[model samples]
Target: MQALLHKIIEQPELHAYWLNTLSMMENVGAKKIKKCEHPIFVNEVILKHASEEARHAFYLKKQIQKIRKDACPTYEWQYLLAPKSSYAYLNQLDIDVCRYLKSKHELKHERLKYAAYLLVTYAIEVRADELYPIYQDVLRAYKSPVSVRNIIAEEQNHLEEMEKQLKAFSSEWEEMCRVVREIESKLHSVWIENLHQELGLS
Candidate 1:
């Protein structure tokens, strides 16, 4: 699975799709953060994270554009013919989760909502930390782009910030983390399946 994921990231066309999809997800995250009602300090931290996410998206989009410009028309067309990218699937999953939470009125309680968001954010940041190194190594191997390294650094910071926020929730931290980990694990499975089907590796 790791090898296949690495292979996907190593391909210019597919990697572009990943980057574009991630950009969309980051934009979604920022929008969600903007809607949350939290303490000033918490909101500020989240806002800073959101801004960094937006910047990451911009960097990724630029990298995608560069990849497209240098890629052959045929290669690009193959990606167009492929199924929805893994990131797209994950993005929709996030949207669905948020919608469900909102519909259930879980988001009506500021503290609960904030805790939920923190858990989700922590899960995502941890996943990013895990995946970014693989992406950085592959990109380095291909001498693809230097921006990814910077993005990885920012991702690490995001992870640290998330950990701090989670720690602040002292009492509920463990339970929330457990729930979020389970949710993320299921999503991760779906992501891998999506990647396999999209790549015709299934």
Candidate 2:
């Protein structure tokens, strides 16, 4: 797992800006899960997520290194620094959903839940996963190096994993949303407290 960072560090094709973006995304993913109302389940999900993200960071770092071996990598701790990057979509999706919900008098509980999942999956996860070969696809059209295409293909497995989890749990999407809202509304402060504690943000 630790070696994954080395792999990311070695990839020359990734830009410094993008590497920093990935670092922020790792934090966002972990923080989003920390906001979950289910503590035991959320904890497990976050732990696994953090590990996977750390590995991804490593991979991305290597990608950055491959591009600029001598360049000193910037390590900013802020998560939302790059607004146009893939992580930006996550923030945008949240705002859009909140805005939509505010306009609705009463969302069907099922729709709300499915919407939330779709918002996260499509807006966040899928968007991030989609960025890969689009970079190469343009290059290929212009006849750029095809080497980066392999990395994009490999990166897709994460999207697959997210889809598998979604498929497994989507049947209960309505119930999950109803329960999530109920749980959230009833214990909103608890979720906030958990986030504060998990992120060590005073």
Point out the worst 10-residue segment of candidate 1 by lDDT: 72-81
Residue 136's lDDT within candidate 2 is: 52
Q: Please give, for residues 21-108, the per-residue lDDT of candidate 2 as tens digits.
A: 6555655654554443243334343355546656655565565554566443555424212333344444545555555544542444
Q: After superposition, how far is residue 28 of candidate 2 from its true place, in Å?
A: 2.7
Which tens-of-lDDT digit does each residue in 61-153 have in candidate 1? 677777777432222324332334443544554555455556643554676567656767787888888877887776676777634788788
Residue-level error in angstroms, candidate 2, position 82: 5.8
Q: After superposition, how far is residue 47 of candidate 1 from its true place, in Å?
A: 1.6
The Cα error of candidate 2 at residue 171, in Å, is 5.7
Model 2 segments more than 4 A misplaced: 1-14, 42-50, 70-72, 75-88, 98-118, 136-155, 167-202
| Range of the 10 consecutive residues with the lowest summed lDDT in candidate 2 | 1-10
Q: Name the TM-score of candidate 1.
A: 0.77
Runs in model 1 deviating more than 4 A are 38-42, 70-108
Q: Evaluate all candidate structures by whole-model CA lDDT and list the values in order.
A: 0.67, 0.46
